[model samples]
Structure formats: structure tokens, C-alpha cells
Target: MAARRPARAAAANGEVRTGGSGRSDRRAELLRIAAGLFATRGYKQTTVRDIADEAGILSGSLYHHFSSKEEMLDEILRDFLGRLLERFTAIEEQGRDPKQVLDQLIEHSFATIHETPEAVALYQNESGALSGQPGFAYVDQLGRKIEEIWIRALTAGQKSGVFRDDVDAGMTYRFIRDTVWCAVRWYRPRGRFRHEAVAEQYLRVLYGGLVTE
Candidate 1:
């Protein structure tokens, strides 16, 4: 399912309503707090009260924005994966060649880890378990869709002689995907190497083999 945007609640005066923006901002903040807790504590271990306490609000007050903890989890995953897929799709569409497409994919992925480490960690740790759960069909669906985009780029590269043809595209894709996404565990936003630098170094090693030619 698509992520639902928070609607502006109408006031009795119908003057676009007071505090609408504040409520939306609060809702986003609550999601961020919940995502961090969920990433570190495990989803099943995190309680609604934990999120509320972190947000400095009463449990009941949290309900004013999100109906339940599950709702918040769903929204977080949906937004994260939805935006990721959208950006990747755009890169593929606009890229001039298969190599260029793959390059941007790797770069954007590192950027995502830098910008939203919690969301990246949460998805990496939880997605496999959530794939078969009810109401999480989109997890698998969108995941496969994202995987296909990468595979397309890799296979196209091989076909066009831009990449080695003997290597299995599926295996190559898995190697690159795991190597890129798993960096979330150790990557730090304030680390000596920024996301762009990390991407550049990775791409250098990836395209230019260590063995002297």
C-alpha cells in the first residue's frame, strides 16, 4: 500500500485550521522516534509506551496522531521503500547507459544510509521476517521490483560489453546489493568518509580491480 499523507484537519472556522502543520510535524517526529526504537529494540520488543515516552508525550496523546504502533511501522516502511523505489526508477529512466545507472544506484544507496540509518537498519533487519506477514505483501512486492531494476542495469551492462559477460548477473547483483546495504551497520553520518566519498571509493574498487593489469 502507498504511504498515506497526513491530512490537514479542518477547523470549525474552516480557515485552513490552526495547528495543522504542527500536528503533521509532530506526527513525522513521532515516526522518526518510533523508527529508531524499532531499529534498535526489535519491532516485537518495542511498545507503544516506549515511543510515547521517547516523544515526551502521554501514551494517549500518541494515539491522537497514530492509531497504533503497527500503523506507525507501516507508514515508516512504506515511505522509506516508496521513496527509494521512486528515486531508483527515475535514475534508471534518465541514465544514459547501464554503467551510469548502476553507479547512481550505488551512490544513492550510500546516501540513503547516511541520511536515514535507522530506516535502512530497520528494513535490513526486519524485512525478511515481515515478507510473509499479513498486510506486508508490499514489502516483498516492492522489494522484488527494486531488485529487478538493479538486475536490469547489470544484465544490460553485460549484454552491451560494458561489464563482464561470464559473471552471472543475479549473483553479481546480490553481491553489490548486500555490500551496499549492509554498510548501514557500520556507516556513520559523521564518520571521516562522507557518503559521496564512500561511494567513490567503492566504485573505484568495483570498476578497477585491485590486481595489477
Candidate 2:
């Protein structure tokens, strides 16, 4: 079973709407279809009909669940970013050594990619353009929030002498963020290496500086 969001959040978001037959399930299924389409086709290019076709429903039926394509897009991005921020916040709050926190953050990222690959890609590809657009201001905010979590861990590590002081923490965080998140382009969950193994190797190179001891 998939994880459940806080009841209040779900209710407020229209995620769990009126008592019904299979309406809720169908709504989620449609959102998943829309997310995959938007992620692959670029949000600007996908149409409601495309999602409806994929979901085997009429375009008219899709509007019953979501008000518009942008609304579907909004909910998808919000759902993905909200969950991601929550996880990162929890990891930071755990108050482990900065390096440890960073490790968990990376692991959480890889796991998210494995589980929500489309959402990850959609945010990366579309969020830059969506920042100032109506209803998507949160996109940039969430992006910054995620980055802040990383910079905090990296800077804290540098301060404690756990990470190299020579490198700028912000730059280092960007480097790692680009490297790890960009891997979704080539990462195959069931291929060559698993996420945990990839993360371990990435950690080795990232922390150990890719130099043989």
C-alpha cells in the first residue's frame, strides 16, 4: 500500500473528496497518468485528453476530478514536493552529524527517484518556468527549501571539520544535487546497480574526493 498523507492535508487538498464509489481511486489513477504524461511530454505540451486517454476515461470525466490541467499539475507537484520537504525536514531534525544527515538526504532522494520518478523529472524540467506563474509560486519555494536543507548539512559539516572547508558549501551542495538528481536520466532501478549501492558509491566518491588513498 502507498503511504497516506496527514488526513487534514489530504482533505484540504481535495485528495480525499466526497463519499463515493471508486471516485477517489480513479482520481489518484488519473493524477498518476497525468503526472507521467506531463513529466515525459513537458507540462506545456500535454493536454487533458492525453491524460484521459491514458487513464481510459473521457476528457469530460477527468474534469470531474481536477479543474484543469494546471490543477492536476499543481496537485502533482505539491504532492511530490510536500512529501520530499517533509522527509528532508525529518532527516535534518534527527540532528545527526552533518555528514550523516547528508547521507540520509541523498538516500531519501534516490529512493524518491525510484518511487516517484515522474514527479522528480517533472519538477526538474518544468519548475524553472513555473516559478512566477500563478499557482506555482510554491514550486520555487519548495525547490529552495530542499536546497536549504542540503546547504545546512554541508555547511554544518564544514564547520565541524567533518567536511572540507576549502569548498563552498553552497557550490558543493549544487554539485551534489546536480550529480545525484541528474542521474535519473540514466538510472534504471532494476539495472546494473541498486539505489543503495549507487548511493554508497556516490558517497565514497563525494566525501572521499574521488582520489585513491
Candidate 3:
């Protein structure tokens, strides 16, 4: 089930008028559809008409929910990155051992790719193009914040003698981040391996080098 937002009560009849509720649901559905198109077609190449066509609604109806294609893209990315940063920040603030925090971060990342592959791909594909564009600055800002979380975790682990001291924390973070996120390109949600399994296997090799002595 889609996660439920807080319920709003109707004033007049004392009945829950879910008219606004239903519209919010439909709007979310439209955003999901748009994200997939933006991920695959490239954000610039996709038109509002394309998303409206896919949703079986007229472009005018789509405009009722979103003013423009850019609006849809903006909402999709903002929600994705905003929620991600929140979760990562919470994990960081927990002050657990660095390895535990890193473990959760990696696991959450794989689960996110499995659950929201379209958003992940959209961010990955369009971030560079949208880097300096107005109204898209949060993309880079939130991205750097996330990067800082991982780098901090790695640095902490190294200082505590948990992770290897020889590895550069920033370089190691990029290596892990790229390798894990790039899986979105080929990962099948219903494929042979579940995300937890993928995460575990990757973590095994990541924490323990591929050497048998």
C-alpha cells in the first residue's frame, strides 16, 4: 500500500471528504509515472504531454495537478532526495559504531534502489545537466550532504581501526557509492536476488577483501 499521509477531516458534514485525499493520491500516481519517463527518456526529452498521455489524462488535466513537466521533475527529485537525506542523517546522528551506521546506509541504499529505481535513475541521469539550473540547487546541496555522511562514516571507521587505514576515505566513499548506485541500471526488482541479499553479498566483499589465505 502507498504510505498514508495524515488524514484531513471535512468540516461541513462531519464526514471525511476524501475528495482532496483522492486528488493527492492521483497526483502521487502521476508523479511516479512521470519519474519513470524522465528516467528513461531523459528529463529534457520528455514533455508534459508524454506523461499525461501515459496517465490516460489530457495535458490540461495534467496541468491541474502539475503546472509543467518541470514541476513534476522537481517534485519527484525533491521528495526522493529529501527523504533520503533525512534517513541518512538520522542514521548518522544515532552515533552508533561507524561500521553499524555504514551497514545500515548501504542496506537502505539497496532497498531504495529496489523500491524507487525510477527516482534513483532520474537523479543519476539528470543531476549533471541540472547542476546549475535555477530551482534545482537543492539537488547538489542534498547530494553533497549525503556524500558527507558516508565520508564521515568511513573516516570514523578508519580512525577507530575498523576499516582499513590505507584507503582514502573520500575515494573509498565514491567507490562504494558509485558501485552500489550504479546497480540501478540493471537491477530487476523481481529478479533472482532480493535487495537484502545483494546488499549482504556486496558488504561481504566490501568489508572483507576478496582474498582467501
Candidate 4:
């Protein structure tokens, strides 16, 4: 499921249609800039002035829409987590075999890494820090909830005799989790391997197994 960790990385960075025109569009653009900054730099370390400077605007202008830096962080994280949950929910509801669902989930994850590398990296770094902290509660909840989703998918496949039942679902999920998302550390959007191709290779190896069939 790879849900969003509550931080200042907004999914709106990926979803916002910026080539248009409006004040709302401008606000979205500002948020996107803030999200990227917050994701790259730690949210706590990023100041409202930093975001405003990045956007080439005054801090007061930045505050016109959002009350404070914390408020912006909250919006970004909420949007990111909310969108990720919706995506995983759709994947869950979509009629696919467990293997296929797992495939889509992994591929989508790579795409997410490609599209929102900063957010993915931010989640990787700050999830531990944000856990159980005030005003970042959804970060913890969404994480557990997303983990359950992945476990269910894996366990369901094992029960259906599609995947090998010998491996523990939790262990398998952790392996996949560590292997795939951690790639964001080295992956560049314009790097040698693209998200889709990397996903295909990973899937081929994952489903086919190391030993020859």
C-alpha cells in the first residue's frame, strides 16, 4: 500500500494541473513548492520564510492562505496521505488476482517514487520521528492501516495457493518494502532506469523467483 507518512509532502505536487491560470492555481503551485522544499529538507527545519523565499513571495503572502508553517505541513501531509489511501483503496477494489494486485501495487510505488521522489524520501526519513507525535497522529494510523493492506494482499495470495505459503507474509512484505522503496535513495527521475522498466524487471524477478522454474 505504501501510504503517505504525515509530513509536508503534498500529493498535490503530482496531481495539481499547474499549466492553467487562477489564484487557486497559484496557491496550488505555492503548496507544491513548499511540499518539495519540506520533503527535501526536514519539515521542522523548513521555515515559512524559506517557503516564501522559494516561491519568490513575502512570508505574509504565504500566510494569506495558510495560517502558519505547521498549518502548511498539516495540509501537505493530509493531502499526500489521503491521496495515497484513495489509490490503495482503488487497487484493493479493482478485480485483480493477488499476484496482479501485488504487481500493480509495486509498479505504482515505483511510479510514485519517480513522480514524488522527495515525498517518498521524506516519508522514509521522518516517519520514525513523526510517529506518536502531536498533530502528526494520522501519520502513525495511516502507516499501520497501509501495512495491514499489504499484509492482507500477501496473506490472501498465500491462502489462495497462488503464492508460496512457506514464507511469512510479514517477512515477505518487509523484503518487498525494503527492496523497492529504498531504491528512491539512488533513483533519479532522469536516471538510467525508468519507473516502469524498473517495475517490470522487479516483477519478473519477484514473481519468477531466483531459482529456475
TM-score of each: 0.91, 0.90, 0.90, 0.84
Better of 2 and 4 by lDDT: 2
Best-to-worst ranking by lDDT: 1, 3, 2, 4
Clashes of 3: 0
lDDT of 2 by residue, 121-199 (tens): 8888988888799756777877888899999999899999998899898888888999999888888888998888888
Q: Which residue segments of model 1 deviate by more than 4 Å?
A: 1-19
Candidate 2 lDDT: 0.82
Model 1, span 90-183: residue lDDT tens: 9999999999999999999999999999999999989999988987788888899999999999999999999999999999999999999999
Separate clash counts for every candidate = 0, 0, 0, 0
Give lDDT per model, in order: 0.88, 0.82, 0.85, 0.78
Pairs that collide in candidate 2 are: none
Considering summed lDDT, which 10 consecutive residues are worst modelled in model 1?
A: 6-15
Which 10 consecutive positions of candidate 3 have the poorest summed lDDT? 1-10
Estimate, for each residue in 1-213, the C-alpha lDDT of model 4 and write its tens digit: 244533333322323434345656677777788778877788888898999999999888876556677766666666666777778768877937888788888888899889877667777877788888898888888877777778889999999999999999999999998999899888889988899999999999998878986
User: Which of 1 and 3 is ahead in TM-score?
Assistant: 1
Clashing pairs in 4: none
The lDDT of model 3 is 0.85
Q: What are the RMSDs of all candidates, in order? A: 3.7, 3.5, 5.2, 4.8
Instruction: Pick the lDDT winner.
Output: 1
